[model samples]
Target: MRLPRFLLAGVLLAGSVLLLTELFAYRASGAVAFSIFTSVWLTLSIVNAGLGVFSAGYRPSEEAAALLPVFGLPAALAGVAWWAWPDGPTLPSPRLFWFLLAGLALWAAIALLAALLIPHATRETALRTAVAIFLPLWLALQVVNLLVGVLIENYSVAEELLILALNFVLTAAMPLAASRLAQRG
Candidate 1:
C-alpha cells in the first residue's frame, strides 16, 4: 500500500479506538480520562495500525525506517502535549513523563515482537500471526500489572480480570479489523 493510504488507515483505526475508549470510559467511570487513558489509547492504536501495515514483506532496512514513526510519533506527541498542557489533569506531576517514556518503550517492544513474529504472507496471515504473538504478551503484561498493582484502582480482582480480558479482545481485534479493511480496499 502507498504511504498516504497506510496513514489514512492508521488515522481511521486511531479514531475508532478512541471512540470506543471514550464510550467505555464514560459508561464505566461516568467521565472520560481524556488526557491520560484516551491519549494513550489513541497513540497505541495509531502506532499499532501502522505496524500492522508495514510489519510484513519489507526489507530489514525499510522496516527500520518504518519503525521511526511507529515509535517516534507517540513520544513526540506526548512531549508536545506535556509542553502545551503542563497543568492538564492527566499529567499534573512531572513524574508522569516517566509513564510516557515507559509507554514508548513498551510500544517499541511490542511492535518489534510483532514485526519479527509475523511472516511475510497474505495480509490475513500476517495479521493472524500478530494477534497470536501480541495477545499472549499483552496478557502477560496485564498479569504483571495486576500482581504489581499498577492500575488496580478500586476494582475487585475479578472485575479487573474481566476488564483486562475485554481490553485484550478489543486491542487484538483493532489491527486485524484494520488489516482486513485495508486488504479489501
Candidate 2:
C-alpha cells in the first residue's frame, strides 16, 4: 500500500486547499468566526496528516515515511502567512493558537492509534473504521465551538454547509484517491 508520488502530491495539494479554504472562510467572516475556525482547521489538517502517515506506513518505505510531515508543512506555512505575520490581524488572545496546536497533536495521536489498530482488522474494514471515528469527533468539536460562543460571528447556514462539504470532500475522498493510486502503481 505504498502510495505513488503523484497520489501523495494529490493528497498534499488537496489538504492544503482545504486548509486555505478554512482560513479564507474565517477571513471572510470576522474575529469570532475566525477564532472558532482556527482550531477546526488545525484539527482537520492534523487528522489529514495523520491519515497520510498511517496510510504511508502500509508500505513502510523510508522515503515515503519521510514525506509524511512534509506534506503538512505547506498548510502550516499558509496559516502563518494568513494569520501570524506583522501587521496581520490581531486577536483577543494567543491562547487559541496553542489550543489549536494541541488539538492537532491530539488528532495526530488518534490517527497513529488508528493506524496501529488497523493491522489487526480486515483491510476491507480499516478505512471505514477510520472514517467512522474521525468524522464524529470532528463534528462534535465544531458543535462545541459554536455552543461555547467561540464562533460568535453570524454565519449564514449556507456558509456552514459549504464548509462541511469542503471538509467532507477532503477527508473522505483522500483515501479513495490514494487507494486508486496505490492499485494502479
Candidate 3:
C-alpha cells in the first residue's frame, strides 16, 4: 500500500472526483456546486486524516494513502445519485435499510473469503489489487445501472441513492478488513 498502490488510488480518486464534478454540472447542482464540494471535501478529508495521525496513532503516509478510497467512493456514489435525479436525493431512501442488511452480509462473506483464500504475505497487495480492479469497474457499471434504473425502472432519486450507498458499502468492506488484517498479522 505504498508507492504503486498510492499512485493508483490517487489516479482513481482524482478521475472519480472529476467525473463527480462533471455530474454535478450535468445536474442542476451546477459547476459551482462541485467547486464548493471539492473545497469542503478537501477540508474535511484533511482534517480527518490529520486527526488519525495525531489521535488515532496512524502514520501520516498511510492515512494519506487511505484518504482517496475512504472518502472518494462515497462521494462518487453521491455524484451518481445526483446525476440520476434532477432534484437530487435526500438521506435514507425508502429501501435503504435493506442495503444495510446486504452490505453487512457482503462484508462478512468477503472478509471471510479473503481470510481463508488470500495468502497472508500478500493480503495488503491483494487488498490494493482488489480495490484497483473494483474501483473503475464499480463506477462504470453503476453508471449504466443508474441510467437503466432511471430511464426504464423509473427509480426515484432516493432509490437510486440507496443503491449507490449499497454499492459503496459492499465494495468498501473487504478492502477495509483486509487492510486491518494486513496491519495486524
Q: Best candidate, TM-score-wise?
A: 1
lDDT of 3 by residue, 108-181 (tens): 33333333234452666555555555556556655655675687679887787667767666656655676667
> Cα RMSD (Å) per model?
10.8, 11.0, 12.3
Task: Give me the candidate number with maximum lDDT.
Answer: 3
TM-score of 2: 0.33
Residue pairs of candidate 2 with colliding backbone atoms = none
| Local error of candidate 1 at residue 185 (angstroms) | 13
User: How many residue pairs clash per model?
Assistant: 0, 0, 0
- Residues 72-178 of candidate 1 have per-residue lDDT tens digits of 45445444544543433232343223333333333334443444344455555555555555567656755654544335355578866765665555555565565
**Full ranking by lDDT:** 3, 1, 2
User: On lDDT, who's better, 2 or 3?
Assistant: 3
Q: What global local distance difference test value does model 1 have?
A: 0.45
The TM-score ranking, best first, is 1, 3, 2
Worst 10 residues of 1 by lDDT: 22-31
- lDDT tens digits by residue: candidate 2, 79-101: 45455432333334443443343
